[model samples]
Target chain A: DAGVTQSPTHLIKTRGQHVTLRCSPISGHKSVSWYQQVLGQGPQFIFQYYEKEERGRGNFPDRFSARQFPNYSSELNVNALLLGDSALYLCASSADSFSYNSPLHFGNGTRLTVT
Target chain B: QQQVKQSPQSLIVQKGGISIINCAYENTAFDYFPWYQQFPGKGPALLIAIRPDVSEKKEGRFTISFNKSAKQFSLHIMDSQPGDSATYFCAAEDDKIIFGKGTRLHILP
Candidate 1:
């Protein structure tokens, strides 16, 4: 089975532009979460969706938004991107969101470079 | 506190030696702790995980020692090899995962 899949492996955008990154979770997975990792830093949580509903959100600004579809796919959108927004956006999936023991499976991630 | 603090931003160990990475968390509510290993240009993969109820857990050459009272946990890689060279992250789980800054481990051949 595929672990997790993400599209647009690498992206480049200008400041103040908008970008959307997509993710497809493993089959039979129902939860999808987003994280942002800057250079030389650990990934920071962005948003988590379970069963097509937003379950949790991190400290990101309003410019960042995400939604999960019925099929368990997800899309992360960033508007008015800034140079600071340049980072690796990762998508993770789990069997369920309520189980702490459920390990997360991650995708390779989309590398976004804002210039 | 919501942060998970990890130490030794980088480490160098000889082959057949042990590599240890430490982490401390301030949140007492965190029940699950996990370690992830990541290679360059790839996403992190779960290495090993432990819960507060257990003092220690081992898998293969990897081990996790957890101290609930001290809110500390560490990962021990036995007989470290060059193939184990990668970035390791310690994380605590609550509503979301709180990840440590990360530790870059290098094993000399």
Candidate 2:
């Protein structure tokens, strides 16, 4: 089975611009989550969608938003991007929303560079 | 309370030696603890994980030692190899997953 897949492996955007990153979860997975990893740092949770509903959110600003489709694919959008937004955006999928026993399968991530 | 603290920031070990990484958490509600390994330009992959109920769990050359009393945990790599050199992260799961800053490990051959 394929692992979690993300689109636009690399992207470059200018400050104040908007960018959208996509993710397709593994087959049979129901929950999708987004995370941002800055250089030399671990990933920080952004948003988590389970069954198309927002189940959890992180400390990110209003500029960051995400939604999951019926097929379990997800899109992460960042508005008014800033240099601080340059980082790798990762998508992870799990079998359920409430169970920590289910390990998360992650994508290689989309490398976003804000100029 | 959601934070997971990990250290040291980086490490270097000789091949055939053991590599150890430590992490501590303040959230007692976190029932699941996992360790992830990542290479450059790649997403983190689960190395090994343990539950609060178990004091230790081992898989092949990887082992997770959990200390529920002190809210601390550590990862041990046996017979470390150069290929094991990468960034490792320790995370705790509650309502969400919280990760540590990450440790960069380099095993010299």
Tens-digit lDDT track of model 2 for A1-115? 8999999999999999999999999999999999999999999999999999999999999999999999999999999999999999999998989545578888999999999
Question: How many clashing residue pairs are found in candidate 2?
Answer: 0
In candidate 1, what are the lDDT values of residues B1-109, reduced to their tens digit? Answer: 4489998999999999999999999989988999999999999999999889999999999999999999899999999999999999999988889899999999999
lDDT to native, each model = 0.94, 0.94
Q: Taking the candidates one at a time, how many backbone clashes does each contain? A: 0, 0
Any runs in candidate 1 off by more than 4 Å, and if so which?
Answer: none
* TM-score, cand. 2: 0.97
lDDT for model 2, on a 0 to 1 scale? 0.94
RMSD in angstroms between candidate 2 and the native structure over all alpha carbons: 1.2
Candidate 1 residue-wise lDDT at A83: 99
Name the runs in model 2 displaced over 4 angstroms. Answer: none
DockQ of each: 0.78, 0.77
